[model samples]
Target: MKHVTYADKALFLDDDSADWLMEYARALGSATMTDTVTLRGIGMDGNEVEATFLLNHSTELITQTTQSGLQGPKNDEAVGYMQEQTRLILTPPPARSVDDPLEIS
Candidate 1:
């Protein structure tokens, strides 16, 4: 177990804080990356939520997440994930040309 002390609030944190948290987690015997944290709670509307932080190991910012039981944010998240999947796939039809009135497809 490693023991170290560091400040919790810093406008801009440096390597010392990162090493400190990693060392502390290791001291606690954690086996995963230190930047990942899971938050679980019931919001004011009484819905339970589980949000996991997806972070850049170096930046420690939540770049993305897997949240449960939250519809609005999930729907918003889907737009970016599903854009490529929502395309129309059409078999080549007769008389279709690259300069057609509508899109070639």
Candidate 2:
């Protein structure tokens, strides 16, 4: 059966402070390009202090045709797998102090 898995990494920025969230998004876009990953979306709240960026990709699936081609069970299995993976990855991390400077190695 042919299976497709879509995956995305998202970052949430708290904009209640003086930080340059747009600049951060631009930097992230450049770094993602270097790593060959596409940035899916960038959004900011009405106040411009809260922002979100989505980075996304999908898995390649290969399938062999049987007499029936693809079956319902196969499709359901693939959907379940992708859903579980997405749930695990999309859970937000614990909140941190936005006033702290980001550490770079």
Per-candidate clashes come to 0, 1
| lDDT by residue (tens digit), candidate 2, 20-84 | 22232234444442112222122222121222223222222122222323222112333343344
**What ranges in model 2 sit over 4 Å off?**
1-74, 92-105
TM-score, one value per model = 0.19, 0.21
Query: Stretches of candidate 1 above 4 Å error?
Result: 1-34, 57-105
The residue pairs that clash in candidate 1, if any, are none
Q: What would the per-residue lDDT of candidate 1 be over residues 5-79, giving only the tens digit for each residue?
A: 223211221233323333333432333333343333333344544444332324332112233333321222322
Please report, in order, the local distance difference test score of every candidate based on alpha carbons.
Answer: 0.31, 0.29
Cα error, residue 102 of model 1, in Å, equals 73
